[model samples]
Target: MNAVTELLAGWMPGQRWFGGKGREWADVTAEGFLLDQSDPVLSVHRVRVTYKDGATETYLVPLSWRESPVEELSSAFIGAVADPHGGENYAYDAMRDRDATVPWLTHLVAASTVGPMRFHPAGVAYIPEGLPGDILSTEQSNTSLVYGETAILKLFRRLEPGLNPDVEVHDALRQTENPHIAPLLGYVEIDNGPGEEASTVAMLQAFVPNASDGWRLATSSVRDLYAEGDLHADEVGGDFAGESERLGEATASVHRDLTRVLPTEPAERDWYRSLAEQMTSRLEAALAVVPDLAEHADGLRRLYAAVADTDEPVVRQRVHGDLHLGQVLRTASGWIVLDFEGEPARPLAARRELDTPLRDVAGMLRSFDYAARHMLVEQPGDPQRSYRAQEWAERNRQAFWAGYSAASDLQLSAGSALLRAFEADKAVYECVYEARNRPHWLMIPLSSLSRLTSLV
Candidate 1:
């Protein structure tokens, strides 16, 4: 048991599947496990642990413990040889184990194919008929194991309480016939406890595959547009007008469905205003480092304050709370929205709050800048070519706004100022995001902020 604990504790810290930040492993307490017929060879252990980064939680780590620690095994674990008294163990990432993951995913699908939920070492798995099958990236908020072409099993990580909104909203919208989102194919609905009051700990739904994430596709478009020659922007195949309109239409359709099936109320003026204020503060805080932005700060502030104060048809209802180019997928059929789960950085309660539809629109519009600017720097050329690329980005940015506004109910009316305000606010937030993680990409939002007052 002690050898098992040491090997697992070291292995877990380096795993993408492990939830905790694995700076240093600590307090590796073995809570429980399912020992297989092959001793520790095929085993699942439940360990409660605290890390050097000050996080404490319980996690399930499956190990391929060996009778003789072999260096020939996978790098995910270190091999431990037998010492005098007992068996020595080595470490390895359980997910990399073919015997473990492949079997685990298969067992999960079989369990989901049956009556209800199945709890195996692989986590909660779900199955629906006719959906595409694949395993989603482990870096995300949940572990998704798709069963065929009809169903998706999402096993939650960083587990939360109650019915997860990703499952609930999609299911409700499916029942209401909403087309903007991927429809649900039922769920596993694990309670984690025997009582009915316990929250759903797992989910299964319709699988969406063969779709290019909008972010990547959009960046490709921007790259083509930002190429060294003026011919780049003129190329309709590279231009983004068609997709922008389709995406806008999708957003509008989603909003219309919300209006019909979901609840809406008067918009919260103070909240929008405060959020705008925060955007301003963040911009100021970041602008201090950029220095080139100080000239435009006052202008941005006035525009932001004005837009935040608009009192028009402010309706609040369910929305794709964390919409962005990254959140959408372009399919052969059309665009498919993925993951109703809100911003993972935000708390569940805050994510569930009803906000203006423009909030979503703003997230997407901000992504336009990211798409355009990210590629602008990628394309190296002479001064004239660089200027041409900047021009291309500008042209596409306008086209995107026009396409979205045409699909939406937004206008230049006094009440509709919130739309523009929110767009700027979104860009301001982007500046912070880019600064902390992608400093070279700061120009994207800076250019966007410069145009804050230009949008009618």
Candidate 2:
């Protein structure tokens, strides 16, 4: 390993966006191209890693080179390296370096091609050039920068062979003028080679200013309910049922637009069996990681069996693959959905596949459970608080379903076999994720499983 690769191998694993954590690296290699050669040089490198298991992955690493490090950028500094010109130079993560972020907007405005990267603007919105962007701290798999208040740029950390679903879905929805979607302003792509599709490197979208995320709003409502000892969820001043209903309507509208512009097909009997098998396979894999899941294994198998045995008519269409409270925003006008990339851990091909919209609905339902019960994680053995949390979750879930049914003309009761199976599958997925990421929070999904397995 050279100086840059060695620096990356040490720094990359500590980053929140790095996905290859816990894996043993057999080899590491990197290649770079200069994006800007001004005072503070900016360069983007593609770092490829070969793991011991023979699996390989590539990551996008943008570094800003400076003659001397500034005091303010001490935290973002990667390390010092020998310059080809014979002097030592400092390197820092470009996304967090304000001086290095200007070239991204300038390139998009000019539609320039730098090395293998191409910047394509949508030509619908004005590009905010000359503005230095600030990196958002809450992102996980991808790093995002807010260009003033006009636009937000999301850089895909992992490299894949095709267009990202976020950019693809947003481009498709542009013609619909869907009020619930944040408009796509532009995107960056890289040439993969002959006979291979171009890969999306980054995407730019209109920023929603003065908007509170759905998770924050929902949790605030839960806090309000908890404060009012005797008051019900609906009676509280911060009741979120109305907002939940509006969010449901917004989701249904997006789903309708997606179906109109994208592909849709009716599910065959074989599809049901295949879905059941997929869910069962995931459960078996999860059981190996989460031993606590063994208790729910029999009940989960029974749930998957119901999914296979049911003859419910279904139509699969392009829907939000990952829907949760954090993925939405509550602006003054209405609710706006964000991040169509689906689960970042899943393969790009699988994320693009059409599926039942109920999967999204189930995801939101599970989020409601999360928002209500998350507070109980810090305060256990409180029956009164637990009852209030369950009450809040049930009330909002019903309201969301009512709004969805009214908008789509698709009424799904809590007992709908398909809905139940989707929810159970989601909970099982949550159990595995919490076990791996947040062990203390595992009980939230485990508690939901108790209720799901008890259903007739």
Candidate 3:
């Protein structure tokens, strides 16, 4: 246990999705196995690690043991362990081991019941057989595998008790036969004892074969606008306003479906003050790090104050939670929203709480701003190009809002002041996010902050 813990301490920091970075590891303990097989020697262990500051997180560590090293999978090598007979054996990340992933898919197809693990089909009449699978290299927060162009399976890395909102919402959408999303096919879950909630292990969905990611499509349009120089965004060959409008319509439809399937509540008068407090807290945190925020602090607080004073009651319901350009796909049949897991840093209970759907609208609105200015970070100081980027962003923002208002029952066109507050709060968030993660991108959100604060 100590040897493996030491190995993981060295290995975990290097993983792309590992949350704990630059933190001193206190200890690592293997909790138990989700799967244990002897023939090919595959084990999926749940391990908990405590940081130096006493923070702890759990991770799913799938490992494949082999007699000899698979030279082709050299990059996936984790470490070697001693066999009971004292002979040396090899271990690797099971997701990278094709031989190891095959059995996992087979289990899902067969609805096999292993110790403490349950595999169940969601939307299928028949199980697929003999399909090949490979891990996708998208650098996601979680790992995903595509099986013969038929289905994609997302394996959750960080484990939390209770059903994952992604799987929960996808299943609801599939039940309603919602066309704006990839259909959920099946899922794997860890079966807990009585009085304990089950944890989601993985989810499988029908893959969209030729769909383009919205981020790529949106950025490509931005590039075209830049190339056209003096031409307006509408004059550009790759104008994305129409697509943005359609995406807004799709978002409204998904939100409707989510509200229908999940629980909801009306926002109480006090809810606004609570929400404003949260926003104020975030703004103060950001201000401490980004001194430029100090200039706009007073103006931003006024916007938040308006939200607290809003008397008109609003509805709170299940939403996409983390809506952004990257979360949607541009397909032949309009747009498909993906990933309902919410912000990963927040607690699971907070993620599941009902909130105004406009929070999602705010997120997408901020994303448009990001898409506009993303390229400028690469090639800075071109005022002409920068002005064009703003034009493109404004054009799409209006189009998206128009489509959303036309399609949804929500009264966002009224500018209830809460919406503007949400937008301002989102900008404040982007400030701190950029300062910490991408300092060069700080200008984009800071620009929005200046524009927002300039408002009366």
lDDT of each: 0.62, 0.93, 0.83
Q: Rank the candidate models, highest lDDT first.
A: 2, 3, 1
Question: Considering summed lDDT, which 10 consecutive residues are worst modelled in model 2?
Answer: 405-414
Q: Which model scores highest in lDDT? A: 2
lDDT of 1 by residue, 1-456 (tens): 576666666666555656566246557776434333343355555566877777766555555655555554545465564656775655444444444444343444444322223432222224433333355564465566656665666655544445666766776676566566776644443334555433344555666768788888877776665453546565646677677778878877777676676677776778767767876787688686666567667777887677567556677777888888888888887777777777755666676778777788777867776666665555433466456556655565566566666666544342356766777767766767777778777777877776666654
Lowest lDDT block of 10, candidate 3? 123-132
Candidate 2 pairs with clashing backbones? none
lDDT of 1 at 285: 83
Work out how many backbone clashes candidate 1 has. Answer: 15
TM-score attained by model 1 = 0.75
Candidate 2 backbone clash number: 0
What are the TM-scores, per candidate, against the unseen true structure? Answer: 0.75, 0.98, 0.96
**Which regions of candidate 2 deviate over 4 angstroms?**
409-413
| lDDT by residue for model 2 (341-382), tens | 999999999999989889999999999999999999998789
**To one decimal, what is the Cα RMSD in angstroms of model 1 from the true structure?**
5.3
Better of 1 and 3 by lDDT: 3
Error of 2 at 130 (Å): 0.7
**Cα deviation in Å at residue 270, candidate 2?**
1.9
Tens digit of lDDT per residue, candidate 3, span 289-374?
Answer: 99989989999889888788987668899887889999999888788888888987787778888988888988888899999999
Residue runs of model 1 more than 4 Å from their true location after superposition = 1-75, 78-85, 88-95, 98-138, 141-143, 146-152, 186-202, 226-228, 232-234, 284-296, 379-416, 453-456
